[model samples]
Target: MITRRLWLSAAAAVATTLIPGPAIAAEPLEVTAPTRVLGAIVAAEGGAAVVVRIDATLGPADLRVAGAVHSVAVSQRGLLDDPRNAPRVGAGVRKILSAVRPDLAATFEANHKAWTLTFVRKVLAWNARLAASPVRGKRIVDSFDRAALLAWAGAVVDPKGQPSPPALARAPKDAAASTLESYVAYVEALVRSLE
Candidate 1:
């Protein structure tokens, strides 16, 4: 009986190894290494400009699709003119973004609302982190910066005041895209401040 049992177990193992089952599951978008790394790069370094510049290069349809991915922010007053460094910064961000693009598409395709909120939370976390850190001129954010971030997040979720503008109102069909555009504008202004 033991011998029979051993033979059966071995046969089962062999069968399992030979038979094709299902594809391996993918990691969640928010927790994936590429997403986290991209977030860190954007938060730690002044990488939002790279995002904005990339957005500018996209055609209208592509830009709308990308809105479903993530938005970049900077503050105009805080922007510094460093044309010399733009190429280097764009290259690094492009490399990381290429890695992230597939996951972003899959996540948005799977659920657009979840994708929007995921990025909203990401920006909020960035805001909170910056707010908590000690301000060093444009290098870090403070309590004063939290309001805009909070308002942006709130507007995306509920669109009623909280610094609401008509453009960000949930328009049923185009809600996700519009929210993304609003997020991009907010981030662009914030990044300008940081730079």
Candidate 2:
């Protein structure tokens, strides 16, 4: 009999072969909120516990920012934390963002500079709260609402109609982007759990 590992490797290879190269090659494999939603769909198609790691990786901040940007509000943290909700939230955000800002899908992939300061500010503000909180077991899905999450992501991706000011003399140009990239990576990993 084939070992589980072997079966998985073979299955992955087959799957990769089945998906057209142009589809995979057309874009970088970065994970966005929409992609996470896609991952959630994949996970749902696969089975439960398929998204637990994704759920666990998300903190309240992600949900709040994603939710806010998407204009949806989920009140209960526990409900958001449920693996069942992962796909729903993910799919919902994808649909909403696609309708509202079709450009984001491409911009997020190519232009790091295009991400607005407002979006960064919102994410930073929310992260500050999470950092300050002493709660150990509390999760992102457990705390933040969909409205909050969408608001944060929207702020990051586009700061139009928001105020602007001169850059801080003391702040390095790349500091914010560097920090955000790290945070994005962390969140992306959670989204990947769905895959």
Candidate 3:
């Protein structure tokens, strides 16, 4: 079993080589909203628990960190355009009906499934990439980069199309850092809980 500290250390080591950033030590991972949600979902024994955790943490996202979670989740379901991505029975889909937003049960279920799928895919991809690219100091890029970039993009633009000057000036940089940091934390928590 991979411990969180060891896993993060390995990841930071790899990232230091591939990513063009200062040689600063990896920041201590923060247990942000997304980290909590993913950890709860992985630790949950039943769909009801999953529904409760997701609702409590992800239901009303007021902060940029939590909102980035919503964005990452929506992207996982292909932005909810196609109905094919939604799970018909699992991922707390049925449990969410009574827990929250009964009218939008399907949407909630789709989001739940999307996040779950993304969790599984990221873990699997992490393992695969780790195994395939075992050589030290090798530069490798993957979906984690895409997710962080997308999170940055989502952070900058206001969906209402009227971003304030202050927001426009600061959101991208802050969101990019927060998104990447929170994403790594979330992934590490998931691996620790699920593995």
Candidate 4:
């Protein structure tokens, strides 16, 4: 008969291999990246003439999304005056936005604050308008995963003002996935514009 220790060791090894690693746990969804790009585009446009306000009532849990948006806008604006530097600045903005997705999702999942949903939707609608504009239309098309990002944004917000912690945690992950795609696209556009 096999020794108990040996059997247990074999089982543990199998479990280690079979169970997903942290990388897998952290393996950003494909959609997460593009969402960042979308957010960046909004920031780039909004930062051009205005600072989009996150609903002031936001608490800790809702801050991830709000904070990411704010950071993206600031970063994008920093690139404005320097045409040669815009690409690098845009890349940096994308990185910051993409990196925050998981944390944002975790916070949303934990809090599921209702007001957050309204805030996200408002932002989404505004973004959609920008995406539709002629001057910036190409930028949005080239950079964003429009439908997925919109859906993800919708999922994070709670329309009824009821708080739901589990849902909030999931929000950031989706947003991050979308952001990643958007970032890649934005970088590409920035590079093209430089040429």
Using lDDT as the measure, which candidate wins?
A: 4
- As a TM-score, model 3 comes out at 0.25
What's the TM-score of every candidate structure? 0.24, 0.22, 0.25, 0.22
Error of 4 at 49 (Å): 28
Better of 1 and 3 by TM-score: 3
- Angstrom error of the Cα, residue 105, model 3: value is 0.7
Per-residue lDDT for 41-68 in model 2, tens only?
3222222212212333544224223234
lDDT against the true structure, per candidate, is 0.34, 0.34, 0.34, 0.35
How well is each residue in 1-195 modelled by candidate 4, as lDDT tens digits? Answer: 899999999999999999987753343322111233333333542232222233434321222333342333333322321223334434444454445554444332322233233334544454454344233312222122122232222322224433332322232222222232343344333223322
**Model 4: how far residue 114 lies from native, Å:** 39
Task: Give the Cα-based TM-score of candidate 1 against the true structure.
Answer: 0.24
For model 3, which pairs clash? none
How many clashes does each candidate structure show, in the order listed? 14, 23, 0, 33
Distance (Å) between predicted and true CA of 25, model 2?
13
- Model 1 off-target regions past 4 Å? 25-55, 63-110, 113-195
Model 4 CA lDDT for position 116: 32
